[model samples]
Target: MGELEQKFAAAFLTEGRWILYFKGLGVTLGIAVLAAILGVIFGTVLGIMKLSFREDGKKTLWNILATAYVDVIRGTPSVLQLLIMWFIVFATWNNGVAVASISFGLNSAAYVSEIVRGGILAVDVGQMEAGRSLGLSKAMTMRYIILPQALKNMVPPLGNEFITLLKETAIVGYVSLTDLTRAANQIASRTYEAFMPLIGTAVIYFVVIKILTLLLGVLERRLRESDQR
Candidate 1:
């Protein structure tokens, strides 16, 4: 066997080292899911506030604050944001997972807010008018009529955001959080076999992203069919 093959065998195919990868995968997934959920909730509120009442020619305090947050987050690199969160914003907090989650969640929210805002704007004005004609208040119209269609539009972009956020969690390793990338790095350092460990990590990420993309495609197709029916 070649030297590379020997390294691979020693690093991954022996002594249950693959378990490290599994554990790292769990941490990565946990961070991604938590961040994505929080991002969606926070982004939805920001999107609604930014989009709402704009026709009235006045901005609310919430809108101003949301706008500033989105701009700051979107304008900054995510790695920088992560460092700031870990070292500065939550300096007193010792939970790496929670810190990583909040950091990525806030970063993801900026993009998600734009996606949601675009989706809501894509909804027809006539829908809101019709709901209003039926005595629905603006809030009721949004909740009952506008939001459903907007949510459908939001799914594709939101799925993309989740995938992006999943990959971004690799940076959590910088804060000493042992995610998949960090686990692979540790293996590389210990085994002195960078190729096998790093390549394996890349393959794992690719496989996960491919599976998620396939699922999202199926969901989009079903939504299209439902709209047709």
Candidate 2:
């Protein structure tokens, strides 16, 4: 037991290991944030396209294309999608961070689109009719009236998506991006002690995720209060 404790301490308590964890945490958070932002923007456009209707109430070409994209992405596993993005589409790009960001962002967009689409659909059609009756163009009505209410409905799902994306970033290390999991793997390799490094990494992830959950809970409460007002 004494020897085991010493080995564990040496593996993680050493000066440089904490820095590795910090750097990995930074990379993971950076990729997740950039991907979430991009995903939200791209997904919003796709959702809007999916919701678009012609004067005759027929679906537009854009809606068909968006549907196909969402189907393809949602039907596939994200890890496989990430692998293809890294190994094939962006094969010429050597930057792992950029590749990971783009891959995750694109993958996330599909699900986010569905979430947004559902939220938009939940709004009453009468709302759109009212806006149009007020002389608001379709675009203006969607932008100002529909989207605001839809977004409030979307908040909880978006929060879950963000959390899922953050955890999914663990696989980014497969592309040689040294995120938290990869950092732990490296430490384990050097120390030849798997438990300490891996457990520490798990603890870090749990703490970070807990913090995010708390923050999201607060935001959800605020949104609910606003709705009541």
Candidate 3:
């Protein structure tokens, strides 16, 4: 037990190294949460634009632009996108957190746009027809009838997407930002022990993801309950 304690002490407790982990956690959560918000907002707009052709199957400019955005983002590597944003687009900006947040948000928006478009399309055709039959216009039916039902379908996928974005934030280290994974790597370099730092970081990530999964489950249950009522 003393040997185990020594290893633990050397890995984490030495010279206030544990502070690194806490700082990294703050950066990770901050960038992920901010990125998720931006993704949802921008993705919703892209999704709406992507659906612009649904009315008459015409290829509108908005739909074309949205399609191009989604395609390019999906085709490229996320790390490259981060590098481009940091080294080129926001080169003068020294805020690593903000840069990472925007980069990940842009990447996430592509996928989230697809999710949003699918969720909206998944609603029953009858729902829209029924709304229109009741003297509602296309936009009104979409807002009043279709969207409410679609929200439930959207929740699960959106939750999953945000969770993925959370994990992907680990790459923020490429920009010299000491996020969680980077913190652990730094710890390993300091202590010359891979087991403790890496494993500890993995545990931290698993705990966060598990908690989020549980919360999503609760939300799903509530959505079901609302449907029943």
- The C-alpha stretches of model 2 lying farther than 4 A from their native spots are 1-4
Per-residue alpha-carbon lDDT of candidate 2 for residues 1-229, written as tens digits (9 for 90 to 100): 9997887776677866888889999999999999999899999889888987789999999999999999999999888988999999999999888888888999899999999999999989999999999999988999899988988899999999999999999998778889999999998888888988888899999999999999999988887786756
Candidate 1 CA-lDDT value: 0.91
Over 4 Å off, model 1: 54-56
The superposed Cα distance between candidate 1 and the true structure at residue 227, in angstroms, equals: 1.4
Q: List the residue pairs that clash in candidate 1.
A: none
TM-score of 2: 0.93
Candidate 1, 183-216: lDDT as tens digits: 8998888888788999999999999999999999
Looking at model 2, which ten-residue stretch has the lowest summed lDDT? 7-16
Lowest lDDT 10-residue stretch of candidate 3:
51-60
Candidate with maximal TM-score = 3
Better of 1 and 3 by TM-score: 3
The TM-scores, one per candidate, come to 0.94, 0.93, 0.96
Off by over 4 Å in 3: 54-56
For candidate 2, list the clashing residue pairs, or say none.
none
RMSD (Cα, Å) of model 1: 1.6
